[model samples]
Target chain A: MSGVFTEEQEELRRYARQWLDENAPLEAVRKIAETPEGFDAAQWSELGSLGWLGIAVGEAYGGSGFGFMELAVLAEEMGRTLYPSPFLSTVVLGTWLVERLGTDDQKAEILPAVVRGDHRLAVAAGRAAVHDLVARRQGTDWVVSGRARFVLDGHTAHTLIVEAAADDGTRLFLVDGDAGGLERNPLSVMDLTRPQAEVTATDVVASPLGDGRAGDAVDHALDRAVAALAMEQVGGAQACLDMSVEYAKVRHQFGRPIGSFQAIKHMCADMLVGVESARSAAYHLASVIDHDPEEAAIAAPVAKSFCSEAYEKAAGDTIQIHGGIGFTWEHDAHLYLKRAKSSALLFGDPRYHRAVLASRLGIE
Target chain B: MQVVVCVKQIPDPSGTYTLDPETHFLVRPDEQVLDDTDRYGVEMGLQIAQAHGGSVTLVSMGPKGSMQGIRQALAMGADRAVVVDDADLKGSDALTTAQVLAAAIQRTGFDLVITGTESTDGYSGVVPQMLAELLDVPALTYATEVEARDGKVTINRQTSAGYDVVEASLPAVVSVTAGVVEPRYPTFKGIMDAKKKEVEELTASDLGVDTSLRQRVTAVEPAPEREAGVKIEDDGEAHLKVVELLQQKKVI
Candidate 1:
C-alpha cells in the first residue's frame, strides 16, 4: 500500500488505458479537434458518469472522493491518448479553485453542478503579477472589465472564473459566460486537441469568489494545476517512446530491422530514460501535493520543468526515429510534437518554472 | 443465488517465461497477475450474482503470494474469496487442481459455479469438467453467453459452426469462453473497499483434500526455431507455381 503505486492505482491505470484505447483513439481525437466545441458533449457526460471529472474533488460535492494521485492517474491516461476534452480547464483548474477557495454557498452552487457535468468552467488569468482584468465594487455586485488571452476552453464554458485586480489586491470573480458586454473569440492554436480563446469583458456583472484577496490562493491553485500538467507530460513522453520503439522493431532498413542499428537503439534507450525519469518526477509531485503541501510547493516547479523538457525531447526523437513518414500530415507523430510544444508553453514553460524553482530554493 | 468463480494466479503472460529443466514446470516469476482467461468467468459470475440476489465468492489455488490476483477479482465487485495456498500443492496437474478447487468451493457452498475454459498458463482445458465430476454437478463448457433463472442456468454454447443453447439445473459448473462479456473495471470505491473484503486462506489439509498428482511431465523440450520461408514473386506464372507447390504438398 505504501509503494510508489498502490495496487488500486495500477488497476485504475489498466482500466483507464483500455477505456481510452476504445473510446478516444487518436483518430477520434482528430475528429473532435475539427469540431467547433473541440469535444463531444456525450463523452463529457460519460466521463462524469464514470466519476472521472471529480476524481480529485471530495465526496461531499458529489465527486468520487479520491485525491490528487487518482487525478494524476486519470490525467496521465488522458494525455497518453491525446484525449480532446475540457478536462484540464474545467476539472483540473476550475473545480480545484472552487473546492479550495470557494465559500460554503459557492461550493454548494458550483461543485455539484460541475461533478454532474451540468456546467463547464474556464479560468482567465494573466501569466504574471500584472493583472489584465480589473474589478470595481458596485453595491452588492461587482463589475469586471478587461481582456484576458489564452483562456483554455473559454469560448464554450458555462462560466468563467476571472482573476482581476480590485482596489485592495488581486481577487477572483465568477462571471457568466454569456453575460452582456462579454466577447469570447476562439484562437487558432497549434495544438488542435486543446483549444484556447481570448475573453474580453466590458462592465460584466460578477460575483466575488470567497472573501479577501486571492493572490496566495491563485498561486496555490496554479501550482497544483502545473503539477497535474506535468503528469500529463509524462504520459505523452511515454507514449512517444512506445511509438518509437514499436516502429523501430518493424521498419526494415539494410536488410534488417532498423532497431538492430546502434543509432536507433541508443535513441530508443534515451527516450526510455527520459520517460522513466519524468514519470518519477511527476508522480512524486502528485504524491506530495496530496500528503504534504509544503513539500509540494517545491516539487511542483521542479516536476513541471523536467517533465516539459522530457516530453519535448521524446516527441522530437519519435519523429526522428520514424523518418520521412513522420514528417507527413497523416502521421500521428506531428500531433504529439505539436502537443508537446503547446503543453510546454501552457502553464509556465521550462524556463519559467526553473526560475521559480531557483527562487523558491533561495538560489541567488 | 450464491455464485462461486474459480480463478488462477499465473505469471504475467507479457513477461518472459522459462521452464525448469529438472521439473519440466514453468518457472513462475515474482510478478504474478490474475490469469487473463479467468476474467471472463469472474465477470460472468459477478453478473449472475448482481442480476439475482446473492454475492459472488472467488475460489482459487496457487502459491501463497497469489492474493494479488485474487484481490483483483475482489476489486471487480466479488463479495469474498477462498484461496487454497499450500506448499505441498506445487506442480498441481489439471485433475489435482480441480480436486483442490472442488474442496474449497464445497466449503463455501455455491448455488452456481463458473470457470474459464482454460488458463493461459496451463491450457489443459479439463479442470472445469473434472471439478463438475467431483462436485456431482452438470458441466457446461465454452459458454459464449449465460443466463440464470428459476433455479436453472441457460448458456449459448459455442460450437464448430454456430452455437447451441444448453440448459442445466441449479448448482452447475459453467466454463465461459473469452469475450463472453466485457469485464467491468473496479471503481475507485470498490478498489478501496477490496482491502477489507474477506479472503479466507486454506491449505490442502485445511480442506482435507488429497493433493497427489495423477499426471506428471516426462520430459521437456524447447519448440523448434522456425525456418526461413520462401517467397514467390507475383508474376504471370505465379499461379502455376502456387498450384505446383500445393500438389507437391498433397493439399490439392
Candidate 2:
C-alpha cells in the first residue's frame, strides 16, 4: 500500500486547503511581505475565526478538538505559503506546556485565550539551540535569570514561557514579556519572514508551572515540537525545490528550455530525490509522534538533517539556475533560502539534531 | 441552510488543448478536466455551508471521469457528490444537462443550488437559469457575494453596469462567476478522506430525464490562433506601440 494519509487526515487536508486558497494565496503572501509588521491582522483574525490557530487545543479551550496531526497539516500549509505567525509558539509550545503542565487555573485562564489567538506566547530555554531540562529554583518568588537566544517569534510574543531552575529541579515558568528584570531584543537574522530574538532574564516575575512535575511533560512536548518543526522544514524545502524546478522549466537558454539541459535536469532530479526521502521521514515522524516518541525523536533528526542540507543545496542551485535574476532583491527565491536556514536552526539544527540522535542511538 | 452547487467539469480553457492539425478541431485524446470557474463555485458552496451550518452536495452531469471533479469538491468540504453518468446522454447540450441536473436536484431536495455562470469550454453561462426554469425555483446568477438569512437568500451579482443586489426565497439556484474565490489545493489527507464521502453514481435513466437534445457538434472548427505582435521598447515606446496597435486594429 502507498503512504497515503488516512481518510480523516484527508478530510482535514481538504478543509485546510480550502481555507488556505482563499485566505493565503500568493497575492496574500505578497501583501504580508509588503506590510511593516509582516502580519495580516485580518487574515490572522480570520484564521482564528476558523479555529485553525487552535486546532490542537482542547475543545474546552475553544479549539477544533483535533489532534497534533491536524496542527501539523496546518503547519505544512503555513510553510508552503510562508505564512508568518506565532503559531508554533503560542499553539504548539505555550499551549502544550500550559495544558499539560500548568495549574488548573492557568489552563482555564491561559489556554482559552491561546486558542482564540488573543494570547501569543514565546519560550526561552536558554542559549543553546538544544538543551536538557535543567533549572535551579530560588525562594517563593522563583527568580529565573537565564539567557535564551534565537527564540522563534520571541520578539513579538506577548508572554514568555521560560525554563528555569527550581531547587535543582527542572521547572517551567510563565515570565511576563514586559517584566522589569527581563529583556528581549530582536536579532538581525537571515530569515526576514519570521523574526528571531535573543532574550535575557533576571529576577523576573515568574510563576512556576507544575513546579518540578512539568519537566517530563515539557520534554515530551519538546520532542513533538522538534518533530513538528522538522516536518515544516521538509515542507518548506520541498517547496523550494518545486519553485526552482518550475522556474527552470519556463526559463529558456540557447533556443531551448533550460530544464531540457542535463545539468539543470540532474539538479532537479537530485532535489526531488532528497525531497521525497525527507518527506517520507518527516511524515513518518509525524505519524508516530503520538504513539512512539523515541522513534519519532530518532526520525526527527534524520529528516531535519537531510532536509536542512537538501533545502540549502536546492535553494543555492535555484539561485544558480536563474542566474542573475534569482540573485536579485526583487525575486522571492532568496526568501525561501532565508526561511530554510532559519527553520534548519530552530529546534536544533541538522548538526545538533544529528548529535542528539547519535547519543540516543548509542552510535558513539 | 442546504446549498447545492451545480459544477461542470469542463476542459481547462486557459491552456492550449491537444489538437490534430489534420482534422482541425480540438482533440481530447486524453482525459477531460474541469473548468476553473466551476472550482470557485464548489469553493463558494463549501464556504456557505461552513458559515451557515448546513450541507453541500455537489451534483454533476458528465461521464465517469467527471467524478474526479466531484471528488475534488468532496475534498473541498462538500458532504457528498451525485454524478449523473450515462452513455446515450453523451451529446446532451447545456439545456438537457441542466434538465437532468434539475431532476437530480428534485430528488436530492436542496435548499439552495450553486454553479458557475459559464464553463470555460462551453462558455454557455446558461445552466443555472435553465435549472431554475426546470425546477420552477428563483435563481441568482453571477453571484460574487451571497448571504442567507431567515430562509431568504441575498446575492450580489456582477453586472455589465455594476453589482446588483438580488434576493430570493428559501430554495434557489446560483451561478458563480470567475474570480469569486480561489479554489483550494487538495491536500494529501483530503484525497484519502474523499474516498469515504458518499459519491452516489446516477444516470439519465435514474433521473428519468430524456437524453435527446437538438444541439450537436456538427462540424468542429479550430479556434483562430492568437498571435503575439506588439513589442514595446520602453515607457515612451509602450504608449506609442499601444496607439499604433490600436490604430492597426481600428480600435481607437
TM-scores for all predictions: 0.86, 0.83
Query: What are the per-residue Cα lDDT tens digits for candidate 1 across B1-252?
Result: 999999989988877888888878888765578898888899999888888889999999988473667877888889999989887788888888898999999989999999999999998999999999999999998999999979999999998657999999998999999999988666677777898999888899998988887678998777799989878999788999999998887777
Evaluate all candidate structures by whole-model CA lDDT and list the values in order. 0.87, 0.74
Q: What is the DockQ of each candidate?
A: 0.39, 0.23
Candidate 2, residue A337: Cα displacement in angstroms equals 1.8
- Error (Å) of candidate 2 at residue B117 is 1.0
Please identify model 2 stretches exceeding 4 Å from their true place: A1-4, A7-38, A126-139, B1-3, B9-57, B64-81, B110-112, B137-140, B144-157, B163-172, B178-200, B219-222, B228-252
**Number of clashing pairs per prediction, in order:** 0, 11
lDDT digits (tens) for residues A1-364 of candidate 2: 1244654565555467657666777567767755555566666666676677677777788775667777777777677767777777777777888878777888888877776667778876533233233344455566667677778767677787877666655677787778887787777767766767778776677787765356456656777676667667666777778888888888999998999999988988988888778778777878887778778768767777776777677677778888889998778778778778777777767888789779879995
The Cα error of candidate 2 at residue A192, in Å, is 0.7
Best prediction by TM-score? 1
lDDT of 2 by residue, B25-53 (tens): 34442245555677788888888888879
Choose the strongest candidate by DockQ. 1
- What are the RMSDs of all candidates, in order? 4.4, 4.7
- Lowest summed-lDDT stretch of 10 residues in model 1 chain A? A123-132
Error of 2 at B157 (Å): 4.6
Chain A TM-score for predicted structure 2:
0.90
